[model samples]
Target: MRDAGESPLLVAADTFRAAAIEQLETWASRLDIPIVSGRPDGDPAAVVFDAINAANARGNSTVIADTAGRLHTKGHLMDELGKIVRVTGRAREGAPDEVLLVLDGTAGQNAIQQARQFTKDANVTGLVITKLDGTAKGGAVFAIVHELGLPVKYLGVGEKADDLVPMDARAFVDALLPRAA
Candidate 1:
């Protein structure tokens, strides 16, 4: 976003994990970006609502909310995600233009199943495959796109903020293919 000249506010809405907010704050401080966060144990939806308002008040054109991660099988957690989506829409018409689900590159077929549930519950529009720099080859990327029909929006290759690179289908495919001996 810094490269694109977009002012984005990072909202730490992952109230379930105290470390999550601290992690986000650390990143925000490092990137010199503004952040809006509520109590550690507060409702995630309320945090999102306030974040949207903060963005408008602070002239931030974009709001990136880091919500709590949940297992697909957790019905209540899934419902919370749905509530966050609705709250976002209510705060701003046509809000949450894109909901991206971040999946672990090493998760294999499980990631695809998670994507299905997340798409259904949170209306996920794209995927962000993380831990791609690990031993896992991220083969599930193909399965996810092919099965779920959702585009891979980004890839987290490393721990650095800049390690999150934008997805390129051609480049990804080329990298996946074995080199001629």
Candidate 2:
């Protein structure tokens, strides 16, 4: 937000929000990114990036309700994708260092693809893939990193707080798709 000036909020999802909410609040108190969001009652990501920018501009941020998206038409899809790009950085007022975008890759294939798109279109600098126990294709990780041009910053190995781990590409390759030798 160019005009955003000193007012910038961090709108985050609910899955791992509890984990980051405190962090955002503490930082917002410092950087002034208003703690306007609690939990997305709906699919906050579905509202398109335009709405995100507008809401953050009005206040620090807003809790996008949980719900479905309207993307049956190509035009709608284009508009949605374009709007997300606008909010993330491409359309940032200054440089879009205000909000923190997060996506959880614990759902399914569609979710992984969605996360990939989020990274591709928005300012997604990292990813958090959850529930990756002893057996997971994780090929999806490579696909996401390479396809989205972003990094898998963290991985959710289990359903606990300590389960979260910073992603190490070399280690991941060695464990999942190591050398044939």
Query: Which model scores highest in TM-score?
Result: 1
Q: Give the per-residue lDDT digits (tens) of candidate 2, residues 8-81.
A: 44544332234554554565576544444444443334333444556656764333221123322345553554
Q: TM per model?
A: 0.96, 0.46
Measured by lDDT, the strongest candidate is 1
The lDDT values for all models are 0.90, 0.50
Clashing pairs in 1: none
Error of 1 at 60 (Å): 0.6
How does candidate 1 fare on TM-score?
A: 0.96
Taking the tens digit of each residue's C-alpha lDDT, what string does model 1 give over 61-180? 999999998999999999999999999998889998989999998899898789999999999999998998877668887877888799999989899988999998787776778578
Error of 1 at 35 (Å): 0.3
Candidate 1 lDDT score at position 156: 90
The all-Cα superposition gives candidate 1 an RMSD in Å to the true structure of: 1.1
